[model samples]
Target: MKIEIPYGDSSETVELADRNVEGVLYPNPVRSGDEQQVLRKAIENPINSPKLEEFLNGKKRILLIVNDATRPTPTARIMEIIYPLLKGKDFKILIATGAHRAPTEEEYDFIFGRLYQEIRDRIVVHDAKKSECISIGKTRHGTEMRLNKLVIESDAIIPIGSVEPHYFAGYTGGRKSFLPGVASYDTITANHRLAISQDAQALRLKGNPVAEEMEDAEALFLKLNIFSIMTVLDSNHKTYAAAAGNLRDSFQALIKKADEVFCVPIKRQAEIVVTVATEPTDIDLYQSQKALDNGKYALKDGGIIILVSACRSGIGSQTFLDLLGSEKSCKAVIEKLNREYKLGYHKAGKMAEIGLRSQMWAVTPLDPETIRKAHMRPFRSVSEALAEAFKEKGPDAKVIFIMDGGLTIPRLT
Candidate 1:
């Protein structure tokens, strides 16, 4: 059988024997609604809170928060829908950079789309390092809720985000735009440290300490007038569902919709798994590691998990590479991560944990040395990586191809 897996902008073809194929994991078949109608209805008829137009009634300065380029959130599309309401208001668009760097020129274009030229001056890129942050309070879990002051200064707040299965914190979007999205370095570092817990995993939120802390942090914003627009996109990035209204209500309301788009089931684990991270998530090793995290669940112990990404931007976080290289084993790497926990170390920890149980390999454009430093072997292409896996595991080895590992979570039935 021959299959083409996405890698960056292109796809890589890998051929395997009929007996060697386990199954190709793709997002479940879901009905995609009209994008405009989905956004319009969500903005008009909200969940628990009043409609968006009503929420913006008495507000003075409006602050629009959006995810960085890392997420597939259709912020520009949302902006287009709401710009008419914000026409006369004093609004500034803030990029929720979290601990990541500001978007590059091209990324800015990708983020703002056609409105870039018009709203260029109104845009404020979040700087976790230099941005002024105020303490909102502390989480019930004891993590401090210091965040960007812009959230407090602005009279009206609107956050546009997409919800999907997150390896940690259960899912991304909702309160996430507040925590790691617009949070201070210390706050983000403290919250993300909880990701080391076994309870922090995909499709779960009840006991996830990271998520709990995030919810706790957002609780402080209850006094403020907030209308959060959360969208659930199908596999094609078409808006299939959306919710608008109060913060927590809108976020929680979209969970079932998100599940419809990301959850995939398999009858059994496979000996080899190929997971590809595409486009923006494929920009670097740090972001692309998400594929490995999700694919790990479908891989047998000692099996090969090949991450296919371009990683053209190089190792995203030097701290990650340093941490992974500091220890000879993933166990040691985890020990160091727990001791000197940082914002990006959780990424390192997740990758290290997976490498502990499986053979980590990659077919990325990243330098071979860079790949090896992260405890993963580098292959020239998906075919090469698959050939290597077959050679080591044997001709009859079962393999699984995760079509969109960045967002797709493979579950065992």
Candidate 2:
């Protein structure tokens, strides 16, 4: 069968093996009883009983932190089970949103769904950035991983998140809920920058020093006695497994399942890139720009890459729009930053190198000038971009197509 694939502002149709091998392996499939069973098992486990009831007994303040946006949000059901368990107890629930900024009502609606009102009324949502976070302590690595004062003040800290394959940290959830979701800005930036700088060539789990450092940071958080409750969600964002004992042991078990669901079908490499944009996560230019790293992996040093962002939602952040205002191209922007702001100049340089190293194009409804300022050639449509890419790369060039490049991580079966 022949399929047309988008590559860097253009598309190319390629012939595939006649074998009917499509969607054979599911990453994480949610069975009907999976979530409730996972929750029930965790509740029934004796080890979790003492602590769970302790929080329910209201002796010490309790904080529940959960992922705000990512798919398969177990928000409603998880809270439904938890709030009842801890009702009339001295406990509080707070949404742990990292530096991604707090969500508005609509976003909150999307995040919490039907549970929005119930969760909102009973619990306080802590914005990691603006909230009164305190310097809990520093890791052995000297990274100051602060926490919300309320969380620090709590007798126990329980974090909830969906485990997924992260581009930098290998996986999300676990101690990530306490760090990026609730830690100070410095800690978040430091950890993120560390991951970005390490092994830029292969941004995978193996042999990456940043992932090790992050694990260390995670350990330090646990060593400080930050008890956590971690859950593993299948691709459907439904709970497949839940662990509720010691923070590390519990998280490790869930991490194992997360690895099974998240890190599947590893790929050696690819030559062409295709990316689809999803928002809030892909809201603004800067946020969406992060997705380019995946394309870097898709390319063969000088391969063509295509981005498809309807982005009708408009540029979402003020800072990003301000930066784009004066810069003509990514390279020019970096040079200008070096000559002017001098701050984050290295990041700008690295970003420019990443952008310029690959032949890139975009198909979006965004203004042509805005696309040009991004240092990308704009195409009229997905088909036009694919056609152009095919013309540019030649009919016989090896091509790779990725749907939703920002969120989808490809693995070989």
Candidate 3:
């Protein structure tokens, strides 16, 4: 059988014998339709809140929060529907960059698409390190809640982003657009410290301390008419479903649709797991780490993980790279992380944790030295990596291929 795995702008096909393949994971089938129409309808009819027009009554100076380039949210389509409705009102779009670097002009053009020309002047890139953030108090979890000053000064704040399974914080969208999206560096680090807990794992929400703390942090701004629009995309990255309304309630509605589209069941664990970081997620090492974390769920102890990511932009964040290169051993990294938790550094810790349990080989555009620094062996081709893994584990080793590693969560049945 030939499996086409996502790699950068295109895909690469790897041929494997049928008997050697254990399973190929994919999101459940979803009805295909006009993506724009779905988004428009979702905006007109919100989940549990008033319509956009009704919600904007007598309100001015709207602050719109959008996910940055690393995320796959359809910002252009969303703005096309929202911009005209708030014609006379004062509104501006803020790119929620979190601690990641600001998007370049070309990247912004790509993110906004055709709408770039119309709303380019009104867009503001959030700087987490800037003094423009204002403290609104702290969450019950003791996270200092400092957000973009615009959020506090604006008459209304609307967060827009895609909903997907997150390694921590349960899922993306909703309160996430605030906590780490447009929040200050201190606020981001403080809230991200909760990631060390097991409850912060993907697809879990009920007792997720990270998600709960984020909700509590966002609740601090509820008085400012904070409505949200969250979207869920199909495997092709097209809009599958969307929900709009009160941040938490609307996000809850989107989560149900997201779960149906992203969760996959597996018969058992595999000794060798191969996965790809598909499109937007494959842009850099910082974002691509999610694939390794998710794939770990389907891998047995002492197994090998062959992750295919383009990492065209190299390691996305300097802080992450520094953390990974700082520690000489996985044990030392874990010890440092336990003593002091940093936002981007946690990603390094996670990679180390996975590395300690199982071996990982990555096929990417990154240099071998950089890949080695992250504790992952680098390969120029997936076939070569797989061949070596098979040789090490014997020819009859059980293997599984995940088409979209960053999005699909495999559950053992």
Candidate 4:
């Protein structure tokens, strides 16, 4: 059988004998209707909160927080319904860049689409390092709750994002737009440290320390009228479902929908796993790591995992690359990460953890020298990587191919 996996802007196909293939994991097929219609209906009927006009009627200054370009949320489409309603009201759009670098003009244009020029003047790109952030309070975990002053001062706070399976923090959306999205570097790093905990795994929410702390941080802003508009995207990147209202309630609604769309059950683990970081995720290494983490679940211990990502933006962040380069071994990386947790560096540590358990090979645009520095074997093509893996495990090795690996969570059943 020949299967096509996402690579860079396009896709690449690989041929594997039927006897050698274990199974292919992908999201369940779902019908989302027309994109604009789905969004319109969601806005017209919000969950656990008043209608849009009722919610925004008396507010003087409204602040809209959006996930940065790294995320695949269709912000501009959501804005079409929102921007018109706040025509006369004072509102500002803040990009929740987290600790990553600010988005470029091209990225902003891509994010906003046709509306870029229309609301360009109202947009404010958040700088986690230099931005003026106000400390609200500390969480039970002792994470200093600091956020952008605009978020604190706004009469109304509306965060827009998509809910998906996150490597840690259970899932993305909900309170994430606040912590890592708009929070200070100190707060983001502190909160992200909880990722090392066992509870913080993908498709998990209950008892996840990282997620619990994020919820606690949101509680600090009880006095503020904060509403969230979260969406669920299908494998094709179209809006599958949307929920708007109280942060917790709306987020929970999206989670229920996501579970049905993204969770794939496998009969058993495979000896070799091949996965792809699709589309926007393939744009950089930082975002592409999710594919590796998710694919790990479907691989047997000591097995080889081959990941295909374009990584067109190179290493994505210097901090992540530096952290990977700093340690000589996986143990050394874990020790350094635990001793002093840095924001972007945790990704490197997580990658090292996975690399320690199983051999990892990458087919990406990243330079071979940089790939070696990160302690990963680099390959020029998917076929090249698979050839080596097959040579090591034999031609008839059980294999599994994961499409849109970053978004699909595989479970052994």
Candidate 5:
């Protein structure tokens, strides 16, 4: 069978032999058609629609923060709802990127299209690294939060992000954009630490530390009078559902859909694995760990793992590269990570150990030296890797394949 997988702006096709081996496929998350309808409905819904009268009633200026991606831009949806409401009031929109690098012109064009240049006068793209931030009061747990003064200075703040299942957060939305995207480094560190807490790891909503951390972040944003509008995209990357109006209500409704669409079952254990990293930064030793986490779950002991990525961007995070440099072996890495780093780091290190034990391979356009440092064998192409794996195994070796494993969801065939 031939399968097509996402590779940046286009798709890459791969083939598999009909040998009764298990296969995993991941469709791009953006669903354009559903996105439009959900955005339209959210705009029209009386209870959820952005209230121009209420917003402009006495407010001097409203600030909006949005996500910038190659596709599935929510700016158009936002403009449709807010345009009528902003007739006589002063308002501006900003892109909240958090610690990630800013979007480029090509990316902006892909995501915002004409809107990128059209909204120049009223839109201000925020650079988290360089922005002049002011210290916000500490959270209840004493996590110092530094936020954009412009966000705090505005009469109202609005956060917009696409909701999807997150690796550690369980799902992403609500106060996420504000806390990590718009928040200062200190705030990010504090909240990130919470992900390792027992509460965050608990699957239950009431006791989940992730949930509690989100609640704390949400309360802080709300106290500052921030309004939130989060989008939930279907498999096709279209807005299938939406939550608007106040922070909590909109997020709660969207969370329900996220749980349904994002939860996929994997029987656990495959003889072969294939993974892709879209964000080149994710291929960086630090961010690349996310890809490892997704790819390792279904991988069997001594199984072959293939990572398909073109990491020309180079490993961007110094801390991550340094950590990898210091640890000689996967076992030592895990021990050091658990002893010195937080729980999330420890968990990641453990995952890395599992991946190392497996027969791992990478096919990339990255420098040979860099790939060497990653401590994985390199293949020239996807086909070459699969061919090699087939030859290395026993005559009756079972084969399994995974595509775009980073955002993968297993389906029952």
Candidate 6:
């Protein structure tokens, strides 16, 4: 069997005996509909809230919060739908970068598409570390809501984002465009600290402290009269579903859609799992680690999981790498994490936790030494990594390929 694993903008092919393959997992093939029409309808006929025109009435200043370059959100397509509606309006576009850096010229183009040139002057790249913020009380969990001043200045807030299965936050979008999206660095670290808890897991929001607190932070923005637009894209990145209106209501409407596309079910765990981080998620090791987290769901304990990512920009979070390199083993890394938790430490903790139970390896553009420092054996190619993994797991070891490891969360039946 020949499989094409996504690597950044391109893909790499790997061939294996058909019988040795368990099955290749891809995002569920969603039934299609006209996405542009759906989005326009969603905006005009919203859920549990007024329509876009109604929501815009009487509001002087509007703030549009959008995802940064890391996420595969259809921001440009969304802009196409609403740009005419927002034209000549008193509004400013803010890139919700969270703790990530400002978008490069290429990334800015990617985010706004053709609209970049038209609205470039009105765009504000949020600088979490340097931006002034105002505290909006604290969550019951004690996470402070230090939001960007841009959020408070606007009388109306519109958060445009995509919903997908997030590794730690159950799902991404809605209130997320507030907390970690445009929030202060310290505030983000406070909220992310809860990620160390096991309850903060994928596809679970009931007891997830991170998800709960993220929702709690939403109350702080209610005074701003938020009208949110959240989308769910299919395996091909085409918008499969769209919801608009009340922040929570719109998000709730899209969660099912997100699950339909991203939550996959498998027959059994494989002895060797090859997971590939798709596109923007493969931009860096830190972002690509989500693929590793999702990979474990399809892998057996003590199995070797090979991660395939381009990591073209290199290690994303230096703190995450430092934490992993500072410790001799994943166990020690977790111990260190427990002692002093930082913003990026959660990534290391999760990866380390996985390391305790399984073998981690990677096929990426990064040097072998950097991969070694993260406690993962490095390979120049997925086939080479799989060959070595199979050597240890045995020639008959069954392998599974997770086509979009960053987004597809697999569950065993």
Scored by CA lDDT, what does every candidate get? 0.87, 0.59, 0.86, 0.86, 0.63, 0.90
Ranking by lDDT: 6, 1, 4, 3, 5, 2
On the 0 to 100 scale, the lDDT of residue 206 in model 3 is: 76
Ranking by TM-score: 6, 1, 4, 3, 5, 2
**Model 1 Cα lDDT, one tens digit per residue, 48-152:** 887788888978889999998998888889889999999888899999998998898888888889988899899998898889988878889887787788888
Which predicted model would earn the best lDDT? Answer: 6
RMSD of each: 1.1, 5.0, 1.5, 1.4, 3.8, 1.0
lDDT of 3 by residue, 260-365 (tens): 8888889988889998898778879999999998999989999999889998788887777777778887778778888876678778877888888899899998
Predicted candidate 4 versus true structure: per-residue lDDT over 51-164, tens digit per residue = 888899899889999988888899989988888888888999999989877888988987898999978899998888899999999999988999999998998889999998
Candidate 6 lDDT tens digits, 337-363: 999988899999999989999999999
Hey, what RMSD does candidate 4 come out at? 1.4
The segments of candidate 1 whose C-alpha lies over 4 angstroms from its true place after superposition are none
Q: Name model 5 segments beyond 4 Å from true.
A: 5-13, 27-35, 46-53, 70-73, 194-211, 278-289, 339-359, 391-395, 398-400, 411-413
TM-score, candidate number 4: 0.97
Structure candidate 3, residue pairs in collision: none
Off by over 4 Å in 2: 1-33, 46-51, 70-72, 200-213, 223-227, 264-269, 279-281, 289-291, 316-353, 411-413
Candidate 6 versus truth, CA RMSD in Å, comes to 1.0
Worst ten in a row by lDDT for model 4: 340-349
Model 5, range 1-413, lDDT digits (tens) per residue? 77665554555677776663565655435434555566766745624445635655688878878775522536666665666667667888777776656777676665555565756677676666678777756666777667877887898777777676555565567776776777765566666766544344312357666566667767766557665677866555556677677777777777667655554556556777777766532434455555555666567788887777655355655554455556666667656765666323534453456556786677776666555555567776777777788788744455555554545544332
Winner on TM-score between 2 and 6 is 6
What's the TM-score of each model vs. the native?
A: 0.98, 0.78, 0.96, 0.97, 0.83, 0.98
Number of backbone collisions per candidate: 0, 13, 0, 0, 15, 0
